[model samples]
Target: MSDITIRHNPDRERFEVLDAGNVIGKAAYKEYDGGASPQRIFYHTVINEEYGGQGLAGKLATVALDETVAAGIAIVPVCPFIKKFLTKHPEYSANTAATTPAHPEFLNEPSPRARA
Candidate 1:
């Protein structure tokens, strides 16, 4: 089994999962200045095809959400994968916004994964 290391790269606005020094997955988000606190809108998650089926996505999501909660930053799970992941892991729900807009404009924007 390969050891996976997760790290938050704020400059790139993403949490990367590395397998032996190679990036294998990422969870992307956009940050906003929320007055008294910061907010993060998670918009995308991707794992290399070769790294699929290894539960790396879940691991990435766990770390990303965990860190955001630790920092007291509100989370807006706009990405379907993140929404679903949060649904399955209800413990992290407290870190999310009380009410996310039904349709966020950012959802319509093209994601890097989509552009690829």
Candidate 2:
């Protein structure tokens, strides 16, 4: 295993995990910035199946959450992986927020994921 790197790709609104400079996984989010409280709603995460059991997802989640917190933005864990990660990491509770109805409604509509 080579050095695993995680970087925020704001253009994609996702944090990508790279293995030796090749993107192997990403934790995707949708950022809502107009409101008084901005948030990054994480809804998808995926790692190359070949990279399974390597803890890449955990690392990806940790970096994603940490960076989101550092940015002073709330994290709305809409993805099962992220939601579960939050449960075991209560330290992040201060920066976490419940998904509101608007979140669901927005998710239901067309999105970058759908377009992709």
Candidate 3:
């Protein structure tokens, strides 16, 4: 919806998509310093149950990722949804900072959507 507003709170490390004054969806992540610059670790993605299956989560993720990427920040998707999204959109893999993390199992297995 054109009226939906996605806002990011850097201090809280969360982003929310509001629809007509109601927060219908939200995605949250923690920023890791990694001894260099901070990299966002996508930890959670949730769309209000009422808003589920409407693609709101995807929209939230897109905006959040775009905003961070525009600011030159890399991302690590620890959330299953986000990992699946990145896997389906290999083009976005370029935005990922680490192909391998201290615990690689944390990453959600990539999807074949983009490859299809």
Candidate 4:
């Protein structure tokens, strides 16, 4: 555990958790026109290898999901870690206006593809 700070940079459109001064985890989002309105999509997020398996990624996702809910944005869990996290924690599922596609079929691998 370290002195961590969680912050969302709207300018860069990313949610991050910092340890001391370095970013330990982050979730990135992008906006696009979804027919009649703008949609914020959670694209990707990563926890630094040094901080892996310590639950920092979950913390980052929770904070990001909270912020997205406050802003009234629909969620898209593009990152496998985030998808798995959501599966385990259904509380955050309320933040989403619509559910994302089913969790990627190959999520059991140690490193899952996120760039889809």
Clashes of each: 0, 0, 0, 0
Model 2 lDDT per residue over 13-42, tens place: 899999999999999998876356899889
lDDT of 4 by residue, 12-107 (tens): 779998989787778987654442444566768888898888888878888888888777776667767777888998887765534334322222
Each model's C-alpha lDDT? 0.84, 0.90, 0.76, 0.71
User: Against the true structure, whose lDDT is highest?
Assistant: 2
Q: Write the per-residue lDDT of candidate 3 for residues 1-116, one digit (tens) a residue.
A: 55778899776678998989777777887666553655778888998887677788888889899987887778888788998888777877878875356424433434244357
- RMSD of candidates 1 onward, in order: 4.3, 2.4, 9.6, 6.8
Per-model TM-score, in order, reads 0.81, 0.89, 0.77, 0.74
Q: Quickly count the clashes in candidate 2.
A: 0
Q: In what order do the candidates fall by lDDT, top score first? A: 2, 1, 3, 4
Write the candidate numbers in order of decreasing TM-score. 2, 1, 3, 4
The whole-model C-alpha lDDT of candidate 2 against the native structure comes to 0.90
- Model 4: CA > 4 A from native: 35-37, 97-116
Question: Candidate 2, which segments miss by more than 4 Å at Cα?
Answer: 111-116
Q: Give me the displacement of residue 67 in model 3, in angstroms.
A: 0.9
